[model samples]
Target: MVGRKKRTTICDKELQKEDLISNLHEPLISEILLRLSTKDAVRTSLLSKRWRYLWQTVPGLDLALYDFLNINFSNIDAFFKFVERFFDSHRESWIRKLRLYLGYRHHICGLKSWIDAVTRPKIQHLDVNYYSSDEIPVSIYTCETLVHLRLEWVSLPNTEFVSLPCLKIMHLKRIRFTSDTTLEKLISGSPVLEDLKLFGCSNHNAIQLRSHTLKKIDMDMDHSSGFVIDAPLLQCLKTKIASTKDFQIISSGFPAKLDIDLQWRRRRPLERPPKKVIRDILADIRRVSDLVITSDILKEFFLYSKSRTVRQFRNLSRLHARFAICDIEMLPALLESCTKLESLIMVI
Candidate 1:
């Protein structure tokens, strides 16, 4: 009797729970749908007539060519048609975010028009990862309302007008800039940018990163490319020095956490040892508390030192090193330099 009573109570509650969600206001339903992916949001239309256009009116739009409506990859035209319909049918006063990903080169033809349609009056976040030779829309450079911008595998535009007054976070990977100054113009215009990351970007032999408001920077560069950092308030820096040019950090002080990857010195009749470039960087950042370095840095650096004393790095507290068997002789020299080290990590 007790078990039967429990089953009856559960069924009674299920019967009492009607379509309460449908009874809510359209604003509430739209808010609920906005939290869903664009494809899942459109699926709600099957639930009832009230949800027919709720997805189109959402504040955020996330559309990828592969995931939209389960479109067939064999027919690329169908995907384009769906995108056109979504742009034409959807209406919004302000879009908070738009994350778009295009897979193939054929999609480049429609990129300009699609960018225009989505560059609304108050779009804040725009993330686009489209691989193509075509340049991204020029409107993106002057997006005043954008706060966070992330681009990958896209060609940057060359325009006289470059302004992003509200931009805070910027991340670019595999981007092809028209010229070296094209990136500089964008960085100069962003008055409030803080966090920056660059990985495997091309079309520049030497890039100068001069910013007053920048706090953190992480980058990867080739042996032919170089960086000139001049951020006064930078807190942390992680980058590789592969250039022969003597680079300097024009900061008030070295970053708190300095993660550096030093290149190997070339031994030849013409090319000389890179003791000065490696030593200058270490001397400039000697005040850093936490440091991560490779064995090549110690190999070329400590081998040229006249004395094995620990006078350079008096403020270093934590040291992490990836030591190789060939350069294990310099490990003792590095440890001997960090007199104030509280933590030591080694990878052999």
Candidate 2:
């Protein structure tokens, strides 16, 4: 038995091509193939001639400023041409999302054709955030594929009308409204919208809203004359106001009652309120259950009470005063008087 020993050795060569093929032919590997970014997808071209086609098949393409910080902006025409070539190389017919965030002065004459080319009907999500030369393109109003729109520091034409039928949500910040009617028409057309946010926008013109599906709205019309809101199914309303002069709120469908923060300051020396101004303001939100009042408004409320009998908040369940320094003692009695109020939050 000792004389019949056998020799064993290991081979250092790689596995055969057929054995490696089985590992590459996987469902998880196929998904990873589809989700590769533009840069990473190009690397796969060196893997093999067969892998070169995978780069063109990937459907997603995102070009933001952070992706190319060192890009030469002085030669804007050349930079865009290179990006266009890259986009044209991708053979995907349908893109799920396209985001363009290039910090350049958006001239209408040069940008119009480029914008029209990218807004294919197949694109479901399109986010275009660009700083313009104080002007917004006209094609934005007629884009029918957008589901969500976010605009900041953009100047839209007064005559331009936005009539996106498929739009579900809109957020406008620091956008100068051209005319009151333009804004009104936009809100009226977007019936399927569920959420809307307006920050630092002037609303001097009359506004009308009629949405069957709208649920939440957060408006910050600070330091400007306010506008009117008339939404039927709006559930939550949160607002911030730095100036209270001529702050008119004419809401007919006083929402499902979520959270209300109302603050009115008396920085302007007004002798007295109009006969029925402030009373009408409080009456509009009489049905809201939760109320959050700031210091200035609380002082006005107590001062108005001293002059005449103002209706106590009967439906309010919770009262929160953010900074109640001198008016801390009156708050406990105010909370107990409201038959429905269960708790009070005060910070002196």
Candidate 3:
């Protein structure tokens, strides 16, 4: 037993850990870094020598260009220098995706320079959530390499030339266009665009969305008028009932899943929709496969059914109805109309 104290194992020398994460394959590390926020990814540089430049090799602004550009810094000129260094570092690299939440008022000028720097690279996915009143750089409209673009609350000026051959997805929300034609030009330029989402966008002038390539459209405007969508291959169209109680949807009958949600409002007894009018609207929505509406709308159809006929929803498979107290009795009528409805959600 006394002799047991004599041996010192080699395992004791392994006190300094193996650092298994750093030894992982380079691509795996890059992917892990990609999941991190642009700021957090760059901060890995301070962890160890192996991690120092690995983050820079990660795709897009995972290299953390946004860290220098997006912050509301006190010494913006200094941050601009860091931005220049970031571009210089990536002069030969391909940045596929970049997201910039451009901060409060003061950083606009430097932020534009940051945006300009990105234009040099073959950027595919660009998300700019800008808060400033000034327009984003027009060069963005002509980015041939952009595959996905999201612009929110930014003023977009009408540019002479717009071309995005590779763009497949576009999300435009609360965008202020110098002219309504700017939106038309942008959509027309994105030849391969398949999915488009518009939220809180209002246009007084006529804009034509004539996209053969478009498969899905999600538009939710508080007030929209004089816009037309001619998507022949349209697979889905999701929209809010714009103009308060006026539901106008062009069901192309291309197996499109049209989503309609009716917003409720109090009206005088005389202001109720005419019996024939409700029947006409119901007939128009006969092909909408997905329908979400208030139960009160069912009451309209119920009252109309007593006089004129209610059209059968042959295509409707899903229905989500929010019930108002007085309109709950009309539930049976709604169920009777949607003969093929497989999924029904009745909200109390």
**How many residue-pair clashes does candidate 2 contain?**
0
Candidate 1 wrongly placed segments (more than 4 Å): 1-54, 67-74, 203-206, 223-225, 243-246, 263-273, 295-309, 320-336, 343-348
How many residue pairs clash in all the candidates, one count each?
Answer: 0, 0, 0
Give the Cα lDDT of each candidate: 0.76, 0.60, 0.71
Candidate 1 weakest lDDT stretch, 10 residues:
264-273
lDDT of 2 by residue, 275-340 (tens): 355455465447677776665555566666633323457777776767656767666556554677
lDDT, residue 247, model 3: 32
Candidate 1 residue-wise lDDT, 1-348, digit = tens: 999999999988775674677777888877887767777888888877877877777777777876653543446687777667766665546677777787655555687877766664677888888988889888888888999999988899788878899999999988888877888788888999999988787644566778999999888754335667889888888877664533457666667888887654432434545666756766755768888888766665665663632666668898888998887877676777777889999999
- Report the candidate with higher lDDT, 1 versus 2: 1
lDDT of 3 by residue, 47-154 (tens): 889889998777766323345555634465765565567667777777777776654554456666666667656888888877677888888877878998998888
Model 2, runs deviating above 4 Å: 1-67, 70-86, 89-92, 100-114, 158-162, 222-226, 245-252, 258-278, 306-311, 318-321, 324-331, 342-348
Report the alpha-carbon TM-score of model 2 versus the true structure: 0.66
